[model samples]
Target: MDEKNHIITSPVMGTFYRSSAPGKAALVEEGQAITPSDIVCMIESMKIFTELRCEHPGIVKRFLVENEDPVMKNQALIEIEIH
Candidate 1:
Protein backbone atom coordinates (compact mmCIF):
# COMPACT_ATOMS: atom_id res chain seq x y z
CA MET A 1 0.00 0.00 0.00
CA ASP A 2 2.80 2.43 -0.73
CA GLU A 3 2.07 5.77 -2.33
CA LYS A 4 3.70 4.56 -5.52
CA ASN A 5 1.47 1.51 -5.64
CA HIS A 6 -1.97 1.41 -7.13
CA ILE A 7 -4.67 -0.85 -5.72
CA ILE A 8 -7.10 -2.28 -8.23
CA THR A 9 -10.56 -3.04 -6.97
CA SER A 10 -13.50 -5.10 -8.08
CA PRO A 11 -16.02 -3.13 -10.11
CA VAL A 12 -18.96 -5.24 -9.03
CA MET A 13 -19.98 -8.09 -6.77
CA GLY A 14 -18.88 -11.25 -8.51
CA THR A 15 -16.44 -14.11 -8.75
CA PHE A 16 -12.94 -13.27 -9.91
CA TYR A 17 -11.10 -15.19 -12.59
CA ARG A 18 -7.41 -14.95 -13.37
CA SER A 19 -7.76 -16.23 -16.90
CA SER A 20 -10.19 -15.96 -19.78
CA ALA A 21 -11.31 -19.51 -19.08
CA PRO A 22 -10.50 -22.51 -16.97
CA GLY A 23 -7.23 -24.27 -17.88
CA LYS A 24 -5.99 -21.19 -19.75
CA ALA A 25 -2.97 -19.13 -18.81
CA ALA A 26 -3.60 -16.20 -16.60
CA LEU A 27 -3.92 -12.75 -18.17
CA VAL A 28 -1.29 -11.38 -15.83
CA GLU A 29 1.23 -12.59 -13.30
CA GLU A 30 3.06 -11.03 -10.40
CA GLY A 31 5.84 -8.64 -11.44
CA GLN A 32 4.39 -8.33 -14.92
CA ALA A 33 4.38 -4.93 -16.56
CA ILE A 34 0.97 -3.72 -17.58
CA THR A 35 -0.55 -0.83 -19.52
CA PRO A 36 -3.73 1.11 -18.93
CA SER A 37 -5.60 -0.96 -21.52
CA ASP A 38 -4.42 -4.39 -20.35
CA ILE A 39 -6.99 -6.87 -19.19
CA VAL A 40 -5.90 -7.83 -15.70
CA CYS A 41 -8.69 -10.18 -14.74
CA MET A 42 -12.30 -11.10 -15.26
CA ILE A 43 -15.29 -10.82 -12.96
CA GLU A 44 -18.31 -13.05 -13.34
CA SER A 45 -21.74 -12.19 -12.03
CA MET A 46 -25.13 -13.49 -12.99
CA LYS A 47 -23.32 -15.84 -15.38
CA ILE A 48 -21.88 -12.89 -17.33
CA PHE A 49 -18.14 -12.27 -17.43
CA THR A 50 -16.65 -8.80 -17.40
CA GLU A 51 -13.01 -8.07 -18.17
CA LEU A 52 -11.28 -5.73 -15.78
CA ARG A 53 -8.64 -3.47 -17.29
CA CYS A 54 -5.76 -1.65 -15.71
CA GLU A 55 -6.14 2.07 -15.25
CA HIS A 56 -2.48 2.95 -14.68
CA PRO A 57 0.91 1.88 -15.95
CA GLY A 58 2.55 -0.37 -13.40
CA ILE A 59 4.06 -3.69 -12.46
CA VAL A 60 1.67 -6.13 -10.86
CA LYS A 61 2.71 -6.68 -7.28
CA ARG A 62 0.22 -9.32 -6.22
CA PHE A 63 -3.34 -10.49 -6.33
CA LEU A 64 -5.49 -9.88 -3.27
CA VAL A 65 -8.10 -12.44 -4.16
CA GLU A 66 -7.75 -15.99 -5.46
CA ASN A 67 -9.33 -17.29 -8.66
CA GLU A 68 -13.08 -17.92 -8.37
CA ASP A 69 -13.21 -16.04 -5.09
CA PRO A 70 -16.28 -13.95 -4.52
CA VAL A 71 -15.60 -10.22 -4.47
CA MET A 72 -17.65 -7.24 -3.57
CA LYS A 73 -17.94 -3.94 -5.28
CA ASN A 74 -14.87 -1.77 -4.62
CA GLN A 75 -13.08 -4.64 -2.87
CA ALA A 76 -9.33 -4.73 -3.32
CA LEU A 77 -8.34 -7.20 -6.05
CA ILE A 78 -4.79 -6.45 -7.16
CA GLU A 79 -1.87 -4.31 -6.08
CA ILE A 80 0.34 -2.74 -8.73
CA GLU A 81 3.56 -0.84 -8.24
CA ILE A 82 3.20 2.31 -10.29
CA HIS A 83 5.91 2.63 -12.91
Candidate 2:
Protein backbone atom coordinates (compact mmCIF):
# COMPACT_ATOMS: atom_id res chain seq x y z
CA MET A 1 0.00 0.00 0.00
CA ASP A 2 1.08 3.53 -0.59
CA GLU A 3 2.13 5.58 2.36
CA LYS A 4 -0.32 8.18 3.46
CA ASN A 5 1.04 11.64 4.10
CA HIS A 6 -0.56 14.28 6.29
CA ILE A 7 0.01 18.00 6.32
CA ILE A 8 0.40 19.84 9.58
CA THR A 9 -0.84 23.39 9.51
CA SER A 10 -0.63 26.50 11.59
CA PRO A 11 -3.64 27.36 13.71
CA VAL A 12 -2.91 31.04 14.07
CA MET A 13 -1.18 33.90 12.36
CA GLY A 14 2.25 34.51 13.84
CA THR A 15 6.00 34.19 13.50
CA PHE A 16 6.99 30.56 13.14
CA TYR A 17 10.02 29.39 15.10
CA ARG A 18 11.70 26.09 14.32
CA SER A 19 13.84 26.17 17.43
CA SER A 20 13.00 27.19 20.98
CA ALA A 21 15.52 29.97 20.67
CA PRO A 22 17.95 31.39 18.18
CA GLY A 23 21.07 29.29 17.45
CA LYS A 24 19.42 26.16 18.81
CA ALA A 25 18.45 22.92 17.17
CA ALA A 26 15.02 22.68 15.69
CA LEU A 27 12.30 21.01 17.73
CA VAL A 28 11.59 18.57 14.88
CA GLU A 29 13.71 17.84 11.85
CA GLU A 30 12.88 16.35 8.49
CA GLY A 31 12.43 12.56 8.55
CA GLN A 32 12.08 12.61 12.34
CA ALA A 33 9.38 10.53 13.97
CA ILE A 34 6.77 12.49 15.84
CA THR A 35 3.76 11.83 18.06
CA PRO A 36 0.44 13.53 18.48
CA SER A 37 1.55 15.34 21.61
CA ASP A 38 4.93 16.37 20.25
CA ILE A 39 5.73 20.02 20.26
CA VAL A 40 6.88 20.53 16.69
CA CYS A 41 7.31 24.25 16.74
CA MET A 42 6.19 27.53 18.29
CA ILE A 43 4.20 30.46 17.02
CA GLU A 44 4.64 33.88 18.48
CA SER A 45 1.81 36.35 18.13
CA MET A 46 1.15 39.45 20.17
CA LYS A 47 4.19 38.75 22.33
CA ILE A 48 2.89 35.35 23.42
CA PHE A 49 4.52 32.08 22.47
CA THR A 50 2.29 29.16 21.60
CA GLU A 51 3.54 25.63 21.16
CA LEU A 52 2.31 23.84 18.08
CA ARG A 53 1.78 20.10 18.29
CA CYS A 54 1.45 17.29 15.85
CA GLU A 55 -2.02 15.82 15.66
CA HIS A 56 -0.97 12.42 14.35
CA PRO A 57 1.98 10.09 14.74
CA GLY A 58 4.18 10.20 11.67
CA ILE A 59 7.55 10.94 10.17
CA VAL A 60 8.24 14.52 9.28
CA LYS A 61 8.51 14.70 5.50
CA ARG A 62 9.28 18.35 4.89
CA PHE A 63 9.09 21.81 6.36
CA LEU A 64 7.02 24.39 4.55
CA VAL A 65 8.40 27.42 6.34
CA GLU A 66 11.85 28.46 7.47
CA ASN A 67 12.74 29.37 11.02
CA GLU A 68 11.56 32.86 12.03
CA ASP A 69 9.30 33.06 9.02
CA PRO A 70 5.99 34.86 9.23
CA VAL A 71 3.07 32.52 8.75
CA MET A 72 -0.64 32.95 8.35
CA LYS A 73 -3.43 31.02 9.98
CA ASN A 74 -4.13 27.65 8.35
CA GLN A 75 -0.86 27.73 6.43
CA ALA A 76 0.82 24.41 5.87
CA LEU A 77 3.84 24.06 8.12
CA ILE A 78 5.02 20.54 7.67
CA GLU A 79 4.27 17.37 5.73
CA ILE A 80 4.22 14.10 7.64
CA GLU A 81 3.93 10.57 6.36
CA ILE A 82 1.67 8.59 8.68
CA HIS A 83 3.19 5.55 10.27
Candidate 3:
Protein backbone atom coordinates (compact mmCIF):
# COMPACT_ATOMS: atom_id res chain seq x y z
CA MET A 1 0.00 0.00 0.00
CA ASP A 2 1.09 3.57 -0.66
CA GLU A 3 0.82 6.68 1.51
CA LYS A 4 -2.57 7.32 -0.09
CA ASN A 5 -3.79 4.54 2.13
CA HIS A 6 -4.67 7.13 4.76
CA ILE A 7 -8.26 6.94 5.93
CA ILE A 8 -11.58 8.70 6.54
CA THR A 9 -13.00 6.52 9.24
CA SER A 10 -16.75 6.36 9.87
CA PRO A 11 -18.05 7.79 13.13
CA VAL A 12 -21.32 5.92 13.15
CA MET A 13 -22.90 2.61 12.12
CA GLY A 14 -24.77 2.62 8.81
CA THR A 15 -24.43 2.61 5.01
CA PHE A 16 -21.97 4.64 2.93
CA TYR A 17 -22.89 6.69 -0.13
CA ARG A 18 -20.55 8.45 -2.52
CA SER A 19 -23.07 11.14 -3.35
CA SER A 20 -25.99 12.75 -1.60
CA ALA A 21 -28.19 11.64 -4.48
CA PRO A 22 -27.95 9.00 -7.15
CA GLY A 23 -26.12 9.87 -10.38
CA LYS A 24 -24.42 12.76 -8.63
CA ALA A 25 -20.72 13.12 -8.00
CA ALA A 26 -19.17 12.26 -4.68
CA LEU A 27 -18.85 14.79 -1.89
CA VAL A 28 -15.09 14.42 -1.83
CA GLU A 29 -12.66 13.17 -4.42
CA GLU A 30 -9.00 12.26 -4.64
CA GLY A 31 -6.77 15.22 -3.79
CA GLN A 32 -9.81 17.09 -2.48
CA ALA A 33 -9.23 19.35 0.48
CA ILE A 34 -10.75 18.11 3.73
CA THR A 35 -11.64 20.34 6.63
CA PRO A 36 -12.72 19.52 10.15
CA SER A 37 -16.20 20.87 9.45
CA ASP A 38 -16.52 19.56 5.88
CA ILE A 39 -19.19 17.04 5.07
CA VAL A 40 -17.21 14.36 3.31
CA CYS A 41 -19.93 11.79 3.09
CA MET A 42 -23.24 10.62 4.46
CA ILE A 43 -24.11 7.50 6.43
CA GLU A 44 -27.74 6.56 6.64
CA SER A 45 -29.14 4.23 9.24
CA MET A 46 -32.49 3.59 10.91
CA LYS A 47 -34.11 5.93 8.39
CA ILE A 48 -31.94 8.80 9.56
CA PHE A 49 -29.19 10.51 7.58
CA THR A 50 -25.96 11.18 9.41
CA GLU A 51 -23.42 13.33 7.65
CA LEU A 52 -19.86 12.30 8.43
CA ARG A 53 -17.37 15.13 8.56
CA CYS A 54 -13.63 15.26 8.90
CA GLU A 55 -12.03 15.83 12.27
CA HIS A 56 -8.98 17.52 10.75
CA PRO A 57 -7.82 19.37 7.67
CA GLY A 58 -6.09 17.30 5.00
CA ILE A 59 -6.57 15.66 1.61
CA VAL A 60 -8.94 12.88 0.67
CA LYS A 61 -6.69 10.12 -0.59
CA ARG A 62 -9.23 7.39 -1.06
CA PHE A 63 -12.72 6.15 -0.32
CA LEU A 64 -13.10 2.65 1.14
CA VAL A 65 -16.46 1.65 -0.21
CA GLU A 66 -18.64 1.85 -3.30
CA ASN A 67 -21.87 3.80 -3.37
CA GLU A 68 -24.70 2.31 -1.29
CA ASP A 69 -22.42 -0.23 0.35
CA PRO A 70 -23.41 -1.60 3.69
CA VAL A 71 -20.95 -0.61 6.37
CA MET A 72 -20.42 -1.54 9.97
CA LYS A 73 -20.10 0.57 13.05
CA ASN A 74 -16.85 2.50 13.06
CA GLN A 75 -15.78 1.37 9.59
CA ALA A 76 -13.33 3.19 7.37
CA LEU A 77 -15.31 5.18 4.77
CA ILE A 78 -12.41 6.99 3.18
CA GLU A 79 -8.62 7.33 3.24
CA ILE A 80 -7.40 10.86 3.95
CA GLU A 81 -4.01 12.48 4.13
CA ILE A 82 -3.66 13.71 7.70
CA HIS A 83 -0.58 15.70 6.87
Q: Where in model 3 is the C-alpha error above 4 Å?
A: 1-6
Scored by TM-score, the top model is: 1
Q: Best to worst by TM-score, what's the order?
A: 1, 2, 3
Clashing pairs in 3: 6-79, 7-79, 7-80, 8-78
Which residue ranges in model 2 land beyond 4 Å of their true spot? 1-3
Task: Provide the global lDDT of candidate 3 against the true structure.
Answer: 0.80
Please provide, for model 3 over 1-83, each residue's C-alpha lDDT reduced to its tens digit, 9 standing for 90 to 100.
56544566666678888788778888888789878888888888887888887777888877779889899887877887776
| lDDT computed for candidate 1 | 0.93
Alpha carbon lDDT at 25, candidate 3: 80
Residues 4-83, model 1: lDDT tens digits: 98888988899999999999999999999999999999999999999988788999999999998999999999999998
TM-score of each: 0.94, 0.89, 0.81
Prediction 1 TM-score vs. true: 0.94
How displaced is residue 37 in candidate 1, in Å? 1.8
> Per-residue error at 48 for model 1, in Å?
1.7
Q: Per model, state how many residue pairs clash.
A: 0, 0, 4
The sequence of per-residue lDDT tens digits that candidate 2 reaches over residues 32-67 is 999988889999988889998877799988998999
**lDDT value, residue 53 of candidate 2:** 81
